[model samples]
Target chain A: MMRIVKDIMARRELLVMLVIRNLKIRYKDSSLGFLWTLLGPILMILIYAVFLRILRIEVALPVLVTGIFVWQYLAMCLGDSPNAIIGSTNLVKKAAFPRLMLPLSIVLANFINFLFSMVVVVVYVRVAGEPFGQLALLPVALITQVALCLGVSLILSSLNVFFRDVQHVIGLLSMAWFFVTPVIYDASLINKVSANPDTQFWLNFLFHLNPMTGLLALYRSALIGLPAPALYLVIPSVVISGLVCLAGVTVFMKFQGRFADEL
Target chain B: MNSDIAIQVEGVGKRFRLRHAGTRTLKSVALDMLRPGKRTVRDLWALKDISFSVARGKTLGLIGANGAGKSTLLALLAGTMEATEGRIGMCGTISSLLELGAGFHPDLTGRENVFLAGAIMGLTRNQMKKRFDAIVDFADIGQFIDQPVKHYSSGMYVRLGFAVAVEVDPDILLVDEVLAVGDAVFQRKCLKRMAEFRHQNKTMLIISHDLNTIQSVSDEILFLDHGRILGHGTPESVIGQYESFSRGVTTSDLRREWGTREVVLTGAEFFDDGGRETSKFKWGEALNVRLHYEATKPVGPSVFGFALSDENGRVVNGNNTQIEKVEIPGLQGTGSIVLRLPSLNLASGTYLFSFSAHSADHQVNYHRLDHAFAIGVDAGKRFEGVCYLPCEWRLDREGAKP
Candidate 1:
C-alpha cells in the first residue's frame, strides 16, 4: 500500500495532467464549453422549479439544485468508470505508470466538476431564498462523496477490463442506481409510502443503505438549511464510504497488473 | 550482484495462457477460472529459461525473427509486462522506446504532452519544465507544438515522443525494432542521438529485426530462435549462425520482383576464375557475371545493371552500363551481357544480388529482379570492415615496446 502511494506520488504530475486532460476533453468540441458545468445544474433547477410550481410541490430550489450537482458528480464518475482503462487503451498498453491514476483521474476530474457545481449551489441558495446556515459544511459533504466515488470508480474500471460486458452492465446499473438514490426526489418522500412505524423505520434504514442517500442528505444540509441528517445515517455513511474507498484501492491494485493482457 | 553490471537476467521465461476457445466474455472467463486446468487452457512458453547480462555502459542488440519472443523479452525488461518465472535485476533508471508516442493524448497540444510524457516516464513537472524548450527544439515541429497532436503528421508525433525520451537522461535505454522510421534525414538525426547516448556511457539494449540496425548500433548481438538463446557474440559470427539456421526455410518464397517487362532477363549466372558457374567467391578471387536477356519489343538506349547488397539488403556496391558509359542503343532480340572482374575486394560475408535492365533515362524498367539470390564471400584474407580496400601495413615510427 505504501509502495503504491509512493508510485502515485512519483507520478503526481501525470495525475494532474490526466485530470486536466479529462476536463479539457469533456468540453473541447462543445460550443457552450465549461459553461456546460453551470448550464447543467441551472437547467435542472429551472425544469424542476417550473414543474414543482405547477404540481404544487414545494421542494426548495436549493434542495433540487444541490441534489442534482452532487448526484451528477458521482453519476458522471460511475458512468465513465467502464471506459476508464478501456478509454485510454493507448496509455494503458504502451506506458507503464501507476494504473490506479487512470480511474483516480476520472474521480478527481468529476470532483472538480462537482466543485464548480458547489459554486452554483451556493449561488442558488443566495438567489432562490434558501437558508445558508450549514453552507460551511460543504467541504465535509464534498470530501465524503469524493472518497465514496473514488472507491466505486476504481472497482468498476478494473472489472470492466476483464469483463467487457461490465460496460453495458454499468450503463444499466447507473440508471437503476440513480433512480434508487433519490436524485430527483427527497428520501423523506418514502415516509408517506409506509403507515406502520416499524415498517417506516426499516424502509428508512434500507434507503440510507444506498451510499448516495446519506451523501445527498449531507450535501443538501451544506447547500441549504432545515435538513440535519440523523446521526445514525450520517455516521455509517462516512464509515462505509471510507471502507468502499479502501476496497476500491484494493480491487484496482488486484486487477491492474493484468490490464495490459486483458486490454 | 555485480556492481559493474547494469542488467542481469536469470532463467527468465514468459508463458502466455492461450485460451484456444476464446473465453472473452465474463460468463465463460469466470467459468474457466472456477474450473482450473480446463481443456481450453494451454500453456505456450514465449520465452524459456533465458539468461544474459549487460555490463554497465555497453550496448546490447537483440535480433530474431517474428514470434521469436523478442517483443516478450523486451516487455519483460521494460517492466511493461512481467515474466512468469525468474528474475530481472537492474541498476539504474530505465527508459523504454518500446513504442513511440506511448502516452500522448491526441487531443492535447504537443506542448502539454511534452510535460505529460515526461511525467509518464516518472519525471516531475519541474524536470519537464527545465527540459521543455530543449525537447521542443529537438522535435523541430515549430509552431505545431502548440497545436493538438492529432493534427500533427505521424512523423511529428514520433519526433515529439523520441525528443522527450532523449531528454530523460536514463542510465539505461531499451529500443524496440524501430530505429528506422521517418525520412532519411530524421533517421540520421535519431542515429546521431543514439550515438550520443553511447558517448555518455549509458547502457542500451536495442532489439531490431532489421539486421543492419542491430549490427550497426550494437557492440554485441544476441540471437534468439523460437524462445531459446542461440548464441551471443560479435555481430559477425552470430548473424552468420542465424543465416545458416534459417537457410533451409528458403527466403525465395518471400523474394520481391517487379518490373514493366518490356525486356526480360531469362537467367543470371556467376562464374569463378576457372569459368566454373557458381555463387561463392573467395576474397581477391576473380568474378564473372552473365545476364541473359530477351527484349519482347525494340527498346532504345538500354542500361543493364547488377547490385550487390549485404546481409541487411543495404547496397554495398552497384554498377550499371549507363554509369560505366557503355550504351546499347535501339536493342532488339535475345542477347547476353557479360561483366568480368579481375578480383573481388568485398569483406567476407553473404551478399544478395539483383539484376535490372532499364531505359537509359531510367523512367522505364524493362526487367528488375530484386533480392534474386545470395552469394557468399569466403574469409580468405581475414580483412575487417565493410570493404577490403587494397593496402599494406607498415610501421612508420621506430618505437620501444616497453
Candidate 2:
C-alpha cells in the first residue's frame, strides 16, 4: 500500500494531466463548452420541477435541485467508470504507471462537473429564500459524496476490464439506485412509507442500507435548511462509504496487474 | 542486484489465461458457468523463463518474429505487465517508447500533447516546460505544433512523439520498433540521436526486426524464438543464427524442385582453399562455390550461375557462364559447376547463396534455388562499407618540412 501511494504520488502530474485531458475532450467539440457540465442536471431539474408543479407536489425545489445535480454527478461517474481502464488500453499497453490514476482521474473529472453544477444549487437556494446557515457543511457533504462515487468507480472500472457487462449493468443499476435514493423525492417520504408497522422494518433497513440515501440527505441538509439526519443514519453511511472506498482501492490494486492483459 | 547492472531478470515469465468463450457479457458468463467441463480456459505463456541482465551502459537489442513475445518482454521490463513467476529488478528511471504515439490525444494540440506525453513519461511539469522548446525544435513541425494533432499528418505525429521520448533523458530507455516509422531522413536523425544517447552511457533496450538497425546499434543481441532465448551473443553470431533460423522456416514452404526436371541442380556447396566444404569464410580468402547438377534425359547447352546476397536479401553480385562469354557443349550426364573466387572481398556479415541453371539463350530456366545456403564472413581487420576493395594508400608531399 505504501508503494502504491508512493507510485501514485510520483505520477501525480500525469494524473492531473489525464484529468485535464479528459475534461478538454469531453467539452472539445461541444459549442457550449463548460456550460454543458450543467446542461444534463439543469434539464433534468427543469423537467422534474415542471412535472412536480403540474402534479401539485409540495417537495422543496431547492432540495430537489441539489439532490438531482449530485445524483447526476454520481450517475455520470458510475457510467464512465467502467470504460476508464478499458478505453485507455492503448496507454496501458505502451506506458507503465500506476493504473489507479485512470479511474481516479475519472472521479476527479466528474467532481469538477459536480462542483460546476453547484452554482445552480446556490442560485436555487437564493431564489427559494432558504437559510444558508448549514451551507458551511457543504464541503464535508461534497467530500463524502465524492468518496462514495470514487469507491464505486474504482470497483466498476476494475471489474469492467474482466466482465465488460459491468458497464451495461451499471447503467440500469444507477437508475434503480437513483429512484431508491431521495434524489427527486424527500427523505420524509421514506419516513412516511416506514410509518406502517408491517413495512417499516424493511423500508427503514433499505433506506439505511444505501450509502447514497444518507449522502443525498446530507447534501439537502447542507444546501437547503433541511433538518440533519440522525447520527445513526449518518454514521453508518459514512462508515460504509469509507469501507467501500477501502475495499475498492484494495481490489483495484489487486487486479491492476492484470488490467493490461484483460484490456 | 549488482550496482553495475541496469536490469536483471531471474526466471521471469508471463502467463495469460485465454478464454474460449466471450465472457464479457452476463449472458455469456452464465452460459459459461452452465458448461462445466467444456475446457473453456487455456494458459498461454507469452514469455517463459526469460533470464538476462543488461549492464548499466550497454545497448541490448531484442530481435524476434511476430508473436515471439518480444513486445511482452518489453512490457514486462517497462513494468506495464507483471510476471506470473520470478522477478525483475531495475535501477534508475525507465522511459519506454513502446509505441510512438501511445498516449497522445488527437483533440489536443501538438504542444499540449508534448507536455501530456512528457508527463506520462514521468517528467514533471517544470521539466517538460524546460525541455518543451527543444522537443518542438527536434520534432520540427513548426506551425502544426499549435494545431490540433488530429489535423496533423501521421509523420508529424510520430516526429513529435519521438522528439519528446528522446528528450526525456531517461536513465534506461526501452524502445520497441518505434524507429520503423517516419521517413528516411527522420529515421537517420533518430538514429543519430540514439547514438548520442549511447555515447552518454545510458542503458537502452531496443526491440526491432530490422537487422541492420539491430546490428549497428546493439553491443549485444538477444534472439528470441517462441518466448525463449534461441541465441544471445555478439550481433554477428546471433544474427547469423537468426538468419539460419528464418531460412529454415521458409525453406520448408518453398518449392524445392520445379521446372520440368529436364536438368536439376542436385546439390550445392562452398569450399575454401583447402577444398573442404565450409560455409564460413574469412575476408579476402578464396571461396569455391560448387554446384552439382543431374540430367534426367540427355539435355545440354545450359548456363549455371549463382547470386550472393547480403543478410537483408539484397542481391550483391552474381555471374553466369553466358555473362562471362564462356561456351559449353551439350551435356548428357551428371556434372558439377565450380565458380571460384580467389579473394572474396565481402565485409564481415552473413551472405546467402542462390543458384540457378538456365539455358544458354537465357530464355528458359532449368532450376532456381533461392537462399539455398548462408555463408558467414569474418573480416580480420575493421573495415568500413559493404565490400572491401583491395587498394594501396599513397601520399605526395608538396612541401618538405624537417
Against the true structure, whose DockQ is highest?
Answer: 2
Q: Model 2, stretches more than 4 Å misplaced?
A: A54-57, A197-202, B20-24, B27-32, B255-275, B279-402
Task: List, residue by residue over B172-284, the lDDT tens digit for candidate 1.
Answer: 99888666777788889988999999999999999877777778888888999789999899998887677655542333633577788889988878898788987778877
| Fnat for the candidates in order | 0.54, 0.83
* Poorest lDDT segment (10 consecutive residues) of candidate 2 chain A: A193-202
What are the per-residue Cα lDDT tens digits for candidate 1 across A1-263? Answer: 79988988877888998898899889887899989988877787788789879998777656677777888888788888889998988787667788899999999998898787777677767888877767666677778888999999999999888777888888788889888987777779889998999898888888888888888888777667757888787777888898999999999988787777666
lDDT of 2 by residue, B78-197 (tens): 988889998899999999999987899889999889989998899999999999999999999998999999998899999999999999999999999999999999999999999999
Relative to the true structure, candidate 2 has a C-alpha RMSD (angstroms) of 6.3
Looking at candidate 1 chain B, the ten consecutive residues that score lowest on lDDT are B246-255
Number of clashes in model 2?
0
Candidate 1 local lDDT, residue B351: 74
Clashing pairs in 1: none
